[model samples]
Target: MSRRLKNNMLTTIAYVVVLLWLFPMLYMFLSSFKFESQVAVPSLTFTPTLENYRAVVTPEFFKHLNNSVLVTAGTVAVSAILGVLGAYALVYSSLKKANNIYFWFITTIFLPAVAVITPVYIVLAKLHLLDTKLALILLNTGAGIPLMIWMCTTYFKEIPGEIVEAAKIDGCSKAGTFFKIMLPLIKNGIISSALLVFIVTWNEFFFAVTATATQSATLPVYMSKFMTQQGYFWGKMSAAGTMVVIIPILIGFFTYKSLVRGLTAGSVKG
Candidate 1:
């Protein structure tokens, strides 16, 4: 085939694959609007209504939403604070050349969270943090901190050393320089990392499902209730699932432009 034709063929293949990957999301979205009785009759002929959305607006739904929001907000706040502090320390401290410390920090990224759940559960149980938002907040922040630090450190390390020197020369304290200069400079990175942390916390199932009971259950755990002892409640499940899926996605969308720039900020010099 000619090069132009080959390029067109590749483009076509890419579009096909993209559509294939999106098919399930599209199906779930459509099925979510469907009533339980209409689920079996899979046709697009029925008019889409706010019935499912209405179902999602109940007190129970709001309770789960509130829990999710609380956990996600707490996780993002804690993670961002710790990430910024940790990243700044690692970059500016005497241990900058300590490869062992850096290596351990980087290695934490590879540790499967499931491996640590037992210890976390024991600790939480002992502290009476089980079935509490505080437990999820602390756990999610700790779980996400490794990656948050990694991203923040990479971005912070790329910052010009002259800026720090300039800040110090201006009689700025270390903490002042960090808060005034570095924080503003790396705001994008902070937002990006916070968004990612929020996404992970919002969709957190294993920890939320296992650690929390109904009182503190997040959206993911609450939605799981749709799968009853007898069988699945497809309508309610779809409604809950759709709601659960949209919040973080909407959060990402709002910050997406900044996040893209932040993720790539250090990758290019000019």
Candidate 2:
């Protein structure tokens, strides 16, 4: 094919791919404001309403929102803090023995969460933490750490050892090297990881479903059960889903520009 034709073809394909991926989300958005009869009508001629969104903003709705915020914040905070420190240790420490001994920490990611849930549940139950905010936070943190470490490590590794050496020559202690010299250097990684981890924990369903009771139910679990209780109340369910979806997307939009810049924050700084 000619270059012009190929370019046109690629553009068309890109449009199709984007539309294909976005089709469901589009439907979900549209359905959020639809009445039950209009929800699956397969036509766009009908008028939309705000009833669903109004219902989604109720006290019950805020309950789920609060649950989501708690879990997401807890997960992101724990993961970012631990991930930063762990990556710092990996980047700076000379304890080869420690490396081998804790290589298993990274391997925890490969294990399916389902594989560990039974024991985790037993332990949490024994501790009376089942269905509590703490259980979700700790579990989400555990799942988030490996990926957080991997992302943070890449950014930390790119930092120059000379900077760390200079800090030492300046009579800086280990604490200073990390908090003063290194942490700022990897702030982008922290931002990237924090945003990404918050998104993940916000959407996480597995443990949120299994471990949390109604008292701590997240948006996903709330939406999942909302449909059943609604008895084919498609509009309300879709509205709830849209609420859950839109908040994170807005969060991303507000932060992603900063996140991209942050990811490369200190690469060339003196």
Candidate 3:
């Protein structure tokens, strides 16, 4: 085939794949505007209504949403602060075996949440922390910090060491160099890292469901309420799902360029 024809074929395949990927989301979006009775019917001709949205937006929903926002914000804030400092240390500190320490951080990323949930639960229970936003914040921060370090380290490594040296010679304290100089250079990487942690902590379900009850449940746990003994409330669930996803979708859409750039930032390192 000619090159132009091959390109056209590839484009068609891409479009088809995108449509297939988005069809479920499109269906759910449409279904949220439907009556509970019409949701499972899978037809597009009926009139859309706001009943599902109204049902989904209860006070309980906002309470759970507030939990999610607070937990996510706390996790991201803690993770970014610690991750930046950790990455900076690994890259610039004079400590021996720093590379080994960096490797240890990378290894933590592979440790599954299930591996430690029992001990974590016990620890939280002893501290009377279960069902608390602080518990979720701490858990999600631990989960996010490793990835943040891994990502921010790349941005740090890409910077010239000489720049750090220059900062020192100019009478910049270690903290001054870190806060005033190095951080500004990697602001995009930090933003990308924080955004990622925000998304993860916001959508966290397993820890939220297991550690939290009525009070500190996040959106994912609230979404589970739809699956009651009566049956799945598809219409209301769809509406809740839409609300749960829309914020993250908007954030990802707005910061996609930074995310893409940050992910690929270290690809061409020497």
lDDT against the true structure, each candidate:
0.82, 0.83, 0.90
When sorted by lDDT, best at the front, the candidate numbers are: 3, 2, 1
Best by TM-score: 3
State each model's C-alpha RMSD to the native. Answer: 2.8, 3.4, 1.9
TM-score of each: 0.87, 0.87, 0.93
Candidate 2 stretches greater than 4 Å from native: 1-12, 97-103, 229-232, 261-270
lDDT, residue 43, candidate 1 = 85
> For model 1, how does the per-residue alpha-carbon lDDT over 1-270 read when each residue is reduced to its tens digit?
899999999999999999999886677788788887786677887767667777667898789889989988888888888877887778778875755665677798787879999999999999999999999999888767876887888888888999899998999998898888888898887888878878878888999987998888988887787788888777777777777778767877888988988888856642
Candidate 3: list runs displaced more than 4 Å.
Answer: none
- Assess candidate 1 and give its TM-score to the true structure: 0.87
Scored by lDDT, the top model is: 3
Any residue pairs clashing in model 3, and if so which? none
Candidates ranked by TM-score, best first? Answer: 3, 2, 1
- Model 3 Cα displacement at 112 (Å)? 2.0
> Candidate 3: lDDT of 200?
81
Q: Could you tell me the TM-score of candidate 3? A: 0.93
